[model samples]
Target: MITQQRKLVTELPGPISKSLAQRRVAAVSSAVSGGSDIYVAGAEGAILLDVDGNQIIDFGSGIGVTSVGHSDPRVVAAVTEQAASFGHTCFMVNPYENYIELCEKIAEVTPGDFDKRSVLLNSGAEAVENAVKIARAYTGRQAVVVFDHAYHGRTNLTMAMTAKVSPYKDGFGPFAPEIYRVGMAYPYRWPTGPENCAEEAFADFVGQVHIQVGEQHVAAVVLEPIQGEGGFIVPAPGFLAKLVEWCHANGVVFIADEVQSGFCRTGAWFAVEHEGIVPDLITTAKALGGGLPIAAVTGRAEIMNAPVPGGLGGTFGGNPLSCAAALAAIETMEAEDLPGKARRIGEVLSARLTALATQFPQIGEVRGRGAMMAIEIIVPDGSKAPDAALTKAVVAACIRRGVAMLSCGSFGNVIRMLPPLVSDISLIEDAMDVLAEAFAEVLG
Candidate 1:
């Protein structure tokens, strides 16, 4: 087993990793990018073992996919057992108990006391696409509403829904039509102020939907309960609830894209719980299948069943192995109380990040729930301009020092930390130590 501690045997992107990078440049497309140059050989808990025999502490959690930690024993056992039995019978062709059981579990755990139904998919983009399909089918409407800085997925339709242009949307033109963009209640960057952001943004959002899209033609209003890639930006209080109420009143199916903030990453089964809002449709992925690939759209049975049979499914929508892993992962989350664990992790992270903010004015803000947290980097010149270069420098420095981190946000100025829920507090502290050193070195 790999030790859950940082160990530097060689410089990052050491000889072996450098050689692999050369090979990768020859074999792989230049379009594909990665967060680090270090090639990973193995991972366990919150530590990744690079090909050069270095143990780097993980702060990104594979962009929040390994909430249960890498290769969790329970998930591994379940997948192994299921794979040995049968790999892919195609749940659509020959139904299996695991698929049915996993859906049952999803219905049980996802928010809502109503009779819920779920359709499993292969990725978060697929789930969002299906959610829109179901909502349109149910409401007989066409327009879909999304917010600024939202990241639905990478598919064509999802690209239309996403806010960023340079990486996700550039040159991917002629996107799906009838996708309306709205302003989010981003408290930190709100012009008026955080105190007035909720009400004002809500009004602007509703006004835009009413005037631009016509509420009657809206099929669904999709949003991340807490925007993830958008700098982990938590909207002002009452913002989400107000939107939910408006969607309900306007006959729009509210879809909560909990793809990044779902499972135990946000201290709740879903981040919408924090706002006490139960959406009509919720899309989930990332941490859902442990480290395996599985996504789901679980919601009101009436809405979910609106799509005719054979309308919503794919060849590998709910693979048997993925279902087994999801079941075991959910079981582990319940058994280990990962949600509570996430809250504790949040306390530690919030304290440390707040301290860092006090020390470095370049840290414009630190925000997020549970284990999902981030620090926005900015110029200390009082203009609050995004400092993407500084952010990149800090993250690269940390990675070089045996701590893996990731930078996100519209401006690419947010250092997002998503450590595994099972990571030790001491491990987190050590990683924070590295982060502080990097910040000091870069800012000085």
Candidate 2:
């Protein structure tokens, strides 16, 4: 008989973890992305074990980088076996089956009735860059449009694509030119609310584009299905569908940045599927590789064929080990019905967080799809004002209680939740209870 994994012991960053963190500070670059110094020695389904014999519940899933549980046996075995056979042949020089098989799987999964093709890359940034390149080549346009509060990637072109300041774009300057920004469908901050709010705001954004640069020069209009690092802002109803319609009418290629929203994170393989709209190009990364690093750009065959033979590819893109891991991960999601799992997870969490919002006025908003969730914290009143201080306090409280969480938002006022889809429901309940207790302690 199998037993449920439990997170035990206390003392937040155990002693050994604390020591290792100190060592990490000296050896690792300061530019790494992480909140604190929690050193994880081992992990399983939703549980993290520290070097000091302490266990903690993880809610971030390595920043949504791991959709499957930590160290999934199938993924581990496949990657290990593949690495032992042939680690790196560089697909550009020597072709491989794993890459082609993974691409076929992507074509089969990505939403669309058209003949779709996919290109593999090493990271989300590369996928975004490739998507933009393909769009320009196909449309013969020089401009791309992205929305405000959108989180694409961290590379130079993607840096320009992202809509936040501070940590992401503070010192990085002279970003890729010709990238335009428009208003995003943020219901919480949309003063009038999500009514005709979408129609009015989007129309205004369209007007701005036409007046500034004209639609004739645009290539693609890209937006995250659900803003990941931008407060998990799910667009209002009809917003995405309407955007696709407008793009089609104006001859602009429609692109969905699903780097964080695809692969069952949102109760669906791709969040855009929820609207039944087919994007010309869709980018996926985080969860695509199970736990390994792999990204892809899946789209219409004609558009994808725009780039010439030598136009796209990287040295390590679609590495054999990573491709094998992706194929195994895709199989796992299908066999386990993880998309259904995401739906169940969302129902349970939304119910819990909605109830907590009544008691805690700081929870200004709680919105997301499936497991890709977030809780926005504001001051006592539901004003546009940010309560980042309170947000930080709640996070500290959770860390103190042996639960690992990650925070994100335009103003750093949101507590994001992207727990592994394969995590135990009991573990999820445990984490939620701990989170409620943290809110209690911090707010009181």
Candidate 3:
């Protein structure tokens, strides 16, 4: 059932999927959203098999969750072995060795040479909220600063920190207060052009912090090194490093929300590594457990310990099975040099996407590092206006042609590609070909 080749024997969203969709409409809440109509029966490597037996190539990686790949053998084996031994027994009530070992691994792999500590949680939102809690506790500051086009998580506090409003925040208010958003060094959309983005953006961020929210009251300045949902917006070079220096000077805790760009997705263990900057706190999730739900806030020992003994914990924070899966995932990432693998994947994406951009003027930009990349679709008249409709059309064509795709960006014009790091060379080529063909069909 876990076939690597993409084979479409029937129409996409074929009979079985159509029936399942009808059932889902009847049984599931409209709030629980879905992007594609094809219901997956099984997935392996870069291929997803739908209930209708159509094989589709997956480029989204479940929005960057399945980095190692769906049903990775190492992850499956570890999870199974751990479940057979014991599945639950809260880490708070009864400590587990696996949980401690996982924390150790977190400290070892994360950036920063100083002693670090971690607290595990069930989701990225929880880890982000906990990071805020830790920073607030440590600095005794009430104000939190986040950048524009940054997405922390979906929790109430994180929703407040998030920059976008339509789907993630639309009816969900009154959000947590005392959270402030400032400018980001988005090169592609810089008003004064990308040349001045680094200096201008950083100055604007600092000025806003001092004018709108005093630096002394700021607990933490959180950001995604490479903005994910807002678009694969890699900041102008030296921007983050400069920001980090300012945060250090102002005694503001710098938190890197690596929820989407961590764990070898960005050609490095963490995206911040590219700029040679070390964050005071780093939140990680998505790829940590290979395919399981797990997240952690790893940071300086002094800051992470600021929270009281009982302040941080959940019923299933670090479940035994998730811990086992994480250990195996980390081992697999290391043994296979997934960071190196991500670089090679980036090369393939860069060559193909750049070629597509040259052909299709609608592709305003192609950005992102490693397996995490995106094409910003725009109008062809050189106005640089976001062409969200064209983006949707291209993505729909990909889905119909037996390839899974996803789109993101505050304006909804970025088609993001987050293929599994374990994807074979042939699979990457095939997926890119399908995407290019989709663009030609839609744009031409």
Between which residue pairs do clashes occur in model 1?
A: none
Off by over 4 Å in 3: none
How would you encode candidate 3's per-residue C-alpha lDDT over 220-268 as one tens digit per residue? 9999999999998999999999989998998889999999999999999
Candidate 1 per-residue lDDT over residues 75-95, each given as its tens digit: 999999998999998888999
Candidate 1 lands at a TM-score of 0.99
**Runs off by more than 4 Å, candidate 2:** 1-6
Per-candidate total of colliding backbone pairs:
0, 0, 0
lDDT of model 3 at position 83: 89
Worst 10 residues of 2 by lDDT: 1-10
Model 2 per-residue lDDT tens digits across residues 1-444: 113354456576777778888888899898886576677777876777777666777788888877887887789999999989999999999999999999998999988879988889999889998999999999999899999888888899999998997788889898999999988888888867778678877887789899987999999999998988888998888889888998899899999999999999999988998888889999999889988999999999999999999898989999999999998888889999999998888988898899889988889888998998889998875465889998898988888777888888999999998888988788778878888999999878
Which window of 10 residues has the lowest lDDT sum in candidate 1?
Answer: 28-37
Better of 1 and 2 by lDDT: 1
lDDT of each structure?
0.93, 0.87, 0.92
Candidate 3: C-alpha RMSD after superposition: 0.9
